[model samples]
Target: MAGSFHGLTVFNNNVHAQNSDSLSQADIAEPLFDIEKETYIGTILQNAANPTFRFDPRKGKSPSAFFAEVDPTPSAPGINEMVKPPTFPNVSPVAPDGLIVSSPGFHFNEQNNAMSAFQNALVPPKPNITISNSETDDGYNVFSKAGCIKCHAGSYFTNHQIIPADKIGTEPSRAKALAKTAKIFAEPLLYSPTENVPIRKNARVLKIPLNNIDEQQLRLGFAHDGKGGYKTPSLIGLYWQAPYLHDGGVAVGYEHNYGLTGTLLKGKPVDPYRSIIALVDRKERQKVIKANASLHSVHITGDGHSFWVDQESGFTKKEQIALAKYLLSLNKGRTEQQ
Candidate 1:
């Protein structure tokens, strides 16, 4: 959408925006919005609120400010950055709300409540006849003892940190997607007119904070020039979400046809339980990777984070199953107690 808007403005017409329909030929095989079960929309907003990109000052302003800048005519890059067409309409620019704002789709306040009450609502299901307490314990033990806790920490099961594509060894395409973002407009133009009079006045700019960041980590986490880092995700209700990883390639659901993509208009259904097993077991993960690579985009590989829990890792088959059961048992709030 940002691409469409930028093409429209920079080219001084709606030709590129109209041409987008011609560009989208493939069927939508993207992951469902019923995501990792911890309010990812909120996480994105928080990331945007941060000043620097991936903790690097060289990255210029954060995504929130960059997209919010409604000034179509930017001077720093020079008005002659592109050839202005004769049909260019002299109209007030629309704020890039669709890029950052949620439409009237989901009810939760994605900008403010991702890590709070909205996240709390994404709990796991209750224990069933097949699941036992001992299984959950074994799973938790395997997760902790295997050193997974170092990164996937806290009640949300994530440290809320961004790691470089190299360190985690995932598909790097999406990480590098925004590497060359231009600072088209300054921060003063970001405030929407909807804000209160005192706060909504034009030309009001607050300097975003740029201190107290882990520079070394930032260096490792993104390009030295400041781009491309994947945020560690929270593992809240692992049972409900299918097609794990930043890319939704590590998916399952087609067999029983019950998972996220099962809705009539969406892609084929997958089994969340089976897909997760594939996530933990390296051999199984390879099969998923192969499948994802065959049909999905380059960014949608199920590879990386090869921390396995199978026999090769010296775990017995029973223990592996136990760990899977324990993972499936994860839930929050009253549902956990039940």
Candidate 2:
């Protein structure tokens, strides 16, 4: 105490105050990226085999044109549907050895179709990861482990397969969801059973088989047969694709359910942070709550089930954030490292 520090105290205090202000500003301000710096870093980190493809959104050019040019052709009725697969236009057939054609069998009449199919086939198989390491490489591992990949695999982020929970033997889970909705609906004094409830009408049509494990069997009755079930949605670029779920019930990244607005139900918000804007108005809040309740009911009933993180699965908030980050990166065309 008797001996003073070597450095000047006044000078040190002034420097510290300046540094504190700098730190405070940094904390409050949004981070900005240097495009040139990012590009340089990206170039260095780019994978030779799976190079990240960047396209200018403002230019409004066709994304497909970047890869190759192909004229649209009518489909053969018996062979395939005219609707393009999610994999179309993104995946190409160029062989690793630089060979254009990978297949030997090509018909003169079906040359275009064959080449298209071959290109699709040539697209590299999706990379697989186990749970422990799945979250390692930019957290895409969590997506694969969570069974999200089962439905959302490929360039377009979908397998284009309509998977039914009943077929997957999750009818009991669906029943639980429906029961929850019914209970919520019963509690709302404003929600009259007689009040032209479109959702109630929609829910009545769901016919889950007592014993069905095969999706094909389930799909015969449940796949949009007026029961309102469809293929699992691709989560590709899901960041830009907001208002999550098939019915667009909940806005992406927010807890507020789109259908739950204006319904009397008491529960924690689905996405409280993102839903603040809607919740500002009492009427709007009611509408969002009602919409969410409807969606929550559907989710529980297994009509349109998306995975969630819970203690049983060891998917914590941290993991969910990591998974969300990985998904957002895909939307931006950024690789796992980014």
Candidate 3:
């Protein structure tokens, strides 16, 4: 249940960390006390002479803390800036048993700083050629009237809230698959960002704030609502993001093909307008649904989010077209509206 940088990590830790069977390739060259590792430093070198003196990082640590432990060089331009291989940084020369620090507070800040910088440097998408103020306004009206603003609200367009499995009505198994995430859920904690390279004693521990988020909503986002759910995403780049729904199930091709079987799997490019039309029109959705029937067992059926603007729903054909065009007109420099 996080929002900023920390929020994303929390989200990853929940649904991914528990069931991930993957091993670390990078953690091999360097090592730490992480749970599932082939080449952890703590494993490679241990004293066999006395069992008391040897330590596996896991013995004293909680599984909830960090995942992988990496030490990327903090500085640029050459040999001097390279990170020394992670050895027992806290091991004392004379202590009876050398210390083994948990993987959590070790060597993470510099790497996170690098990641933050890369993200900050990214540019927002520019307005597309087809976008126009009048058309965008028309689309906005249809969008609001159609009740999309309910969950896809706010300046960023996502309430960041989970739409329940029953409500989204797409695939429930994918969301329910994450139910085990709650077992590992813990408060997001870290050594303060300002700390030095070798984190010293008395390093400030920070608890990432999960403000404005409902605890149930947060848990369900990871839990997938007991049965599962979909988190509302920002509608910012709808300009060309096709195969519209979460499962990438709602697909409509450039030459009027439909579904994953007919489109993406067959090298047919998706058309943004037609895909959006299929997204809102129940009649077109049936075509997509039937086209994807082969994959329904694997849950790629283009189902759910039953909101519609088709003639059956009383909206005119012209209004439906306007809505599709308007969604694509986003980022043509129109300000974000709720």
lDDT of each: 0.47, 0.34, 0.59
Off by over 4 Å in 3: 3-6, 9-21, 24-109, 113-117, 120-124, 127-129, 195-204, 332-338
Tens digits of per-residue lDDT for model 2 on 243-269? 443434444134434443422234433
Model 3, global lDDT:
0.59
| Displacement of the residue 222 alpha carbon in candidate 2, Å | 9.2
Count the clashes in each prediction: 8, 25, 3
Q: For model 3, how does the per-residue alpha-carbon lDDT over 140-191 read when each residue is reduced to its tens digit?
A: 8998999988887776667777778888887777777546434333444555
Candidate whose TM-score is highest: 3
> Which digits, one per residue and each the tens of the lDDT, describe model 1 over residues 133-201?
666678778888777788888766788677777777777776764333212211212223133322322
**TM-score (all chains, Cα) for each model:** 0.56, 0.33, 0.68
Candidate 2 is scored at a TM of: 0.33
Off by over 4 Å in 1: 1-130, 182-194, 197-203, 216-227, 254-267, 296-298, 333-338
- Judged by whole-model lDDT over C-alpha atoms, candidate 2 comes out at 0.34
